[model samples]
Target: MSGHSKWKNIMHKKEKSDAQRAKIFTKIGREIAVAVKEGGPDPASNSKLADLIAKAKSNNVPNENIERVIKKAAGGQEKSDYEGIIYEGYGPSGVAVIVETLTDNRNRTAGDLRHYFDKFGGNLGQNGCVSWMFQEKGVIVIEKAADVDEDKLMEDALEAGAVDVNSDDEVFEIFTEPNDLHNVRVALEAKKYNIISAEDERIPSNYVHLDNEDDIKHMNLLLEALEDDDDVQHVWHNWENEGEEN
Candidate 1:
């Protein structure tokens, strides 16, 4: 089973619930603000900002909201200086978990994250604890449009520096080296492909399957709590999907 994609599906299902859209907006807005602060408000001059803009649009973030965040960051309205922090931990059934956060106050965010881990069936760990189990990779998602030729698309991606490509019912997942993401994405765009999402992500080396009901419940809670935090940007984990078979 593909753990990351299955978990993404679960997250998408939950996004249908009330208030989830607001949460998504907030998360994407924070990303946009950070990108602008790091580079600039102009996507043309800032590759990172451009990628974030594409991501926000793929997630259905309103154009006005993205513009507002970029303008605010550029105008110094976002006064709080945030730093990126990664927290490693183990969820139920010893599933490796990594939480990425952008925080202005490290102490508070750490404390809250520790509390969530403790409240669930997990314990926070030191840096590099479980990160070794994952490798950084670029993931590009393209929707499976009508009349699209899968083999031809795969050939194009490979020729454009993509390392791997996988297709399912809904989308084609392309993998590339972290540094080659933008280049490969631009190449695909030149071919007039509809890019659904493109970003750097951690790919787990292995997955731990949770069959026990209690473990599944606790793991779900742990994921939910971590994702709910305002400082938390991304949560990577190695849990085998329940419905998807290897």
Candidate 2:
């Protein structure tokens, strides 16, 4: 998770931008709608919905908007049938790229993603082509503070069923099994830890370093292009930032 943290920091900065925030809200709204349809509007009765609510709140999504979307979805007013789609491919320098999208039209999303990969000098591959390099894990990031007790936090996370607790000067990355994410997060919340983000993520087993100037440039373009698509919810890749951690 060396370069990944920096990459996340970069994306977080982008999320602060006006355009990206609007896109984030739209994407998160679709997630809420789907969660409501799958489970129920009641977060207490629906664990998935509850986790999504927490995720939305972490992203600074307004409470009113979340309630409105849940109501609309529960009322059967949101007729757009969106489905989750995953596309696996390689970006510049053979960096494994996994693009997750929630879209009503599969063809449109596929075409748009294919175009972005092609335009950026990357070729989209068949499903599982690049995903084999990744693993599904529950990742929780907590911003490190001066007064925080690192050892106690690690012990707490481990006791909560976390597989690993990686701490640096910047943040504490707690890893857990995919199914244990919400439970571990809940435990940490109970302990009053400042969680920056908690969600399921694809952790790459090995990283691909992009050192060439052209490779880095094209890789950035590919990522930006993929992220700009409204259908694309999350973009996971193994591009290692060749620099020290923040």
Candidate 3:
């Protein structure tokens, strides 16, 4: 937990260009569509949908866009049938990698991912090849500010059913059971904590360090390629890239 500062990754994402941010919104919209189709348009009754709505808001997705996507999805206006897929592999220096994607065409997604990995000095592997090295958890991140009380926040999070809290100069990271994410987030919001992000994430059991400059370069390229893919939603890796700029 100490090595995995999720805030670093969050800040990196926040610094992306406008076009990349739009791509992020589109990917999240697809997720919202799927959630609506599975449960319903009403976030009140659908916990998954509720969580996704919170996630969308944290990413600065506008309320109108969220409502429009929900309405369209509920009306069956979205015709694309997307399925969730998880791909596990290893990057340079045996760094474990897991990619979560939602794609209408599995063949195209697989081919693109494999090609990227190969070109970047990595290899896509069979399912569970690297997934076993990670654990799924609900992570809630809050931006640390001058007015925020660290002790009070920790107490509030624990009272709200959070398992643990980790902090750095920039943020407070609260960990919870995967199913308890929504409830904990709601509790924190009720307490008036400004949540930066709340979503389920796969935390690596251990991290891999790249000593060679080539390994580091290739690892970064591989991660960027996976993240830039239209079908890829979340990319998790075991690289201990705490100080390095991504």
RMSD (Å) of each candidate, 1 decimal:
2.8, 2.7, 1.7
lDDT of 1 by residue, 1-246 (tens): 253464365446445423687887887788888889888899988988888888888878889999999999999999888899999999977999999999999999999999998888899999999999999988888878996799999999999999998877778888999989988998998999999789888888888988878888888788878878899988888877633321
Tell me, by lDDT, which candidate is best: 3
lDDT of 1 at 235: 84
Clashing pairs in 1: 1-246
Residue pairs with backbone atoms closer than 3 Å in model 2 (clashes): none
TM-score of 2: 0.93
Per-candidate clashes, comma-separated: 1, 0, 0
Error of 3 at 181 (Å): 0.4
Candidate 1 global CA lDDT score: 0.84
Best-to-worst order by lDDT is 3, 1, 2
Model 2 Cα lDDT, one tens digit per residue, 26-55: 888999999999999998888888888888
Q: Which 10-residue span in candidate 1 carries the lowest summed lDDT?
A: 9-18
Candidate maximizing TM-score: 3
Q: Would you list the rank order by TM-score, best first?
A: 3, 2, 1
For residues 199-232, could you state the per-residue lDDT of candidate 3 as single tens digits? 9999988888788888888887887788789999
